[model samples]
Target: MLARNLPASQTTEKVVENCPIVMGFDLKYARAGFTVMQSVLETTPDAQFCAFNVLHDGLPDFAQRLGHLLFDGPRSSITFIDVRPHFDHLELFETRHLSRAMYYRLLIPILFRNAQAVIYLDSDMVCRRNIFAMVDALPPGACLGAVRDNISRGDRARGAMMRDVMDHGPEDMLELSLADYKRDVVGLDNPDRYFNSGMVFFRPSEITDSDVQACFDLCHAPRYCPDQDILNTIFGDRTHLLPERWNYVLTFPETVGLIPDDWMRHHREEEEHAAILHWPGPRKPWRDPSVPQAEVFLEMGRRLDERLQEVAPEFFKDVLPAS
Candidate 1:
């Protein structure tokens, strides 16, 4: 493994204010998706939040839909931009989803240029905590911060996914593991590292100073999950390991003896303000109905969906019932 030394205290120096410039993006098909995320920000009085989407072209219809959804004045905080000119490479837009790539490639730069610090989240996440406070927790100059992924479980899942999707041979899968797939192949070592890309935060300097570019270059070469792999590689050591309270994934079994039941209920009820709830697996609220957290997630999804439709009727057709 390659290691680089950086200034210890410099990485801990706070550059941005306590508030974070929150961001998330949605592809057009997600259906009023980003709007629900924006609602949390609008309701949050402490943090300065912004939601956006990067379209192939600036579709007027979608813009109108966004306007209606955010008619309550937070529209000023939301943006719909075209990234075609800003990022000319098609390969850069190929992984995960373009909306996600755009979040990193385009928005990260803009954040740096603005001299702001922000946490970039995926649209699938639900905000349950005070986001700004979560950002404030990062040590100053820390290039990135995120919760660690459950590696033992993630490796089994990733292996199965590759076998199911790519028909990879057992040997190929084994080789990937031997090559430190969970580490080098995946961009960082397991246990101490390997975080889900659903949530990440960093200062603008990290991206502006070639760190982001370094991650991008490594990702494009092998064609991996662009966001997670790139982030793991770039902020390997610099990332602050925040408590599970912030970006809690619903994978830990009840037997883990961790999060208290009452707190789980509070987070589910949006009472604790848990920064974000990441349905980090395939069982998304609107798409997968059998998820153990289905009922709670569905209720939230439906209410938000209805709210969006009432305001932006044309843009948000009924979200397809948990396909």
Candidate 2:
């Protein structure tokens, strides 16, 4: 159990004693998920024991095996929650990068009601630093915290689409013209601050039922990144943009030269001191280890494979097919 009385009104430099981290994944990424958990345990060895709330589709055998492996160590406690029931409402939406959008709005709040704050990390990422530091540094009154998106830099079309839906209504989003999304949706007055939803530090207590419903309603609208877009639309103003080091997005070597020098410098710094490595685009490390810096992810996967072979050979069947 976690402390639930943390104040949600203003910035308070205080850190919670016990922070709970949550992650959502499907069977397709179970191995990656295990690697992520293992990395966190390995990196934050000194932090007091933490709890990991893993939300996944119900698979008895896989869940049992994962439980045994994760619980074998005393550094963390694991709780598995089956999210199959939430699939019904998501059937109409196209699940491009996300397995289920409801996991962000509905599932997290419910599962972490007792927690004052929960760090929600995508299973595809690996932890490189003590995540509790971010949890401790969370700004008060903010519903969500995340790193600024590096890929969304010049793409102003997304902002335009969001503006269309907000101004004319959800039905008009697709019909809107794409002049400049960043200037339109993100607002010219405010700094162009779009965040990547891959790694989020959420204050579940601050999110209300109405906010969840608003997120669900936004999901019905036509958007490129549904859950991410909805979250930005709803909490964009209240979001606390953390330093990029916390959620460093990886880039490929071939395309690296195409980006601006400043961007390259930022990425290099992030790579050097990355607390979490996020494989954002379609080219993931598992699919193509030839990508620069992919060795890190591949190493984690290799370690997970070895552990699976040793403790639970049956679960090894879930490993990705040889490329």
Evaluate all candidate structures by whole-model CA lDDT and list the values in order: 0.51, 0.65
Candidate 2 RMSD to the real structure = 7.7
Error of 2 at 238 (Å): 0.9
Best by TM-score: 2
Candidate 2 lDDT over residue span 1-323, tens digit each: 11112112222324346468777765566667777877776666443566877777664565546656754566678877777676555633454444463344346766676787888888668776677778756778898898877666533423334453333345445454432443354332343467878888888878887887777665555555566766777788878988887888775344344445687677776666677888866677888786556777777667667767777676564543323
The model with the greatest lDDT is 2
Off by over 4 Å in 1: 1-29, 46-60, 67-76, 90-107, 110-112, 151-174, 186-191, 251-274, 313-323
Clashing pairs in 1: 11-140, 12-140, 13-140, 128-273, 128-274, 129-273, 129-274, 129-275
User: How well does candidate 2 score on lDDT at residue 235?
Assistant: 80
Candidate 1 on 272-319: residue-level lDDT in tens? 334456665455656765654445445556666666667657645533
